[model samples]
Target: MLDLHRLRLLRELSHRGTLAAVAEALSYSPSAISQQLAQLEHETGVPLLEKAGRRVRLTEQAEILVRHTETVLGQLERAEADLAASLREVTGLLRVAAFQTAALTLVPNAVTALARSHPGLRLRIRQIDPEQAIPTLTARDYDVVLGEEYPGQPQPRVPGVSLHRLGRDPLRLAVPDSFDAADLADLASAPWAMEPSGTSPRRWAQTVCRTAGFEPDIRFESTDMVFHASLVATGHAASLLPDLVWAATPIPGRLLTLPGSPARTLFMAVREGAHDHPAITAFHTALRTSLTTLKTTLPLPTTEADPAS
Candidate 1:
């Protein structure tokens, strides 16, 4: 039988990407973490990790073990939750991982609401990209992960994970305040500050520009919407920013909807069987309520005006 404690350490190491980081996160000395992993490997009778320069990489056998360990850990967590439910209390630590914009705009409100409603529930949050968030959630490091998918660029299917749509956010084109470009075609020659390659927004923006008969000249790349908006404000670069990003920071320039005004779907991912846990259920409910309220409070760019409205 694999030691649950050691398995947890292994999951932490994988999520954090280094022994030192895992140690710091779990409040253990690096040497102690190493010793524990070594003991775990000895008990399993297989090489779990191999050093590559200053960092260590998990072996194929270790990867397989980690996958199974996640299932076992999830089951154990569910069992504990069942016992707690029998006691009629909502209690447990719920760790969440979310992308930047959601982390900045949505999570704070959701967390606050959850805290007010369920004082016994503990919540921890980390900001990371969706691509990294899903894998970490599947590894048992996070109980819930917030994710987004741009229209026409759906999220990749990951087995054993379930998605719950929390809300939808519109994506708009931001341009310099002084410039009055009528359409995407007119802005074809303009420089763009886009998300990094392979991200959904970047790909969607590129497609929109390409459909307009010109390739966008990408001048800056970042996942941060605040940074993107700042670039647009300074006339450094125009961009496609989601409404959530604008909610977090004041836009300094004019915002325009693209020809079709695309939107992205925001969702939560939880391990399939772990959804019924009271803490997880409470957190999900809080998130949905927060997003619904945010839609009304945040300013969304109006539909294309007829030059007079």
Candidate 2:
């Protein structure tokens, strides 16, 4: 019989791209992984890997095995979900990843709600960029990931991942107190703080600026939106920030709604077959309830005459 464990290692290698990476992630030695793959080759009676420079690439046969492995893994998840549902209590560790804004604003409240409601369930969370988090999620590092989608820049679909929308948070232009900006066009030449290039936020910010007929002068680049806010607050740079940034702290400066009053969509992503898992379902409910509280407390603009109002 083919070894399911060895097949899983092959699937891991395919996703992680290197023996060293797969080893580090799964807490196994590279040589041990290689030995297992060798055994897998012996069982299959077909070569499943090839050398490509210093690295290795999967063979055509390996790719075929990986497709089947994906289906098998997904079925295993469904089995696990069924077992969990048959239990009396929702109890287990749920690892989660979230970006800074959601980490700062929504997650804590959700955690509190979960603690109160599901006392037996435990959670481990890490602040991660959605770009990095989603891949690790597919690699089985996280049970759920809280991610955001900027308007018009939908995240690409991954075969085994499922996305569930949580809510929308408004995006607005933030200007230094000394700057008088009516719209994005007014700040075309201004120094700006933005997420680094190639990130979803950076791409969306650039598109928003280009649509307004100019490219932004991104003077400061960081994944930290809090830092971006500080720069805008102290008259150093302008930025496009989301509503979640000011959920706790007061707004630092004048806020202008972006064109069309665009808002980023927040969602939770899980592996496809595990969507009905009891723990995941409970956490999703807590998150949505927390968002309800946020909606009640969020600051609303006072007047149409001033964007900052």
TM-score of each: 0.75, 0.91
Residue-wise C-alpha lDDT for candidate 1, range 1-309, written one tens digit per residue: 889889888877776778998887667799999999999999999999999899999888888887887788778767876876776668878899999999998999988998788888888899988787796565567878899988788887766578988877777888888666867788888888998998888898899899989999999998888999999888888888888886688886888887765778889998877777778878888888887787767666567332211
Pick by TM-score: which candidate is best?
A: 2
Which residue runs does candidate 2 get wrong by more than 4 Å? 52-55, 302-309
Per-residue error for 272 in candidate 1, Å, reads 1.6
Residue 47 displacement (Å), model 2: 2.7
RMSD per candidate (Å) reads 5.5, 3.3
Error of 2 at 245 (Å): 0.8
| Candidate 1 clash pair list | none
For candidate 2, what is the TM-score? 0.91
Model 1 stretches with alpha carbons more than 4 Å out: 1-77, 302-309
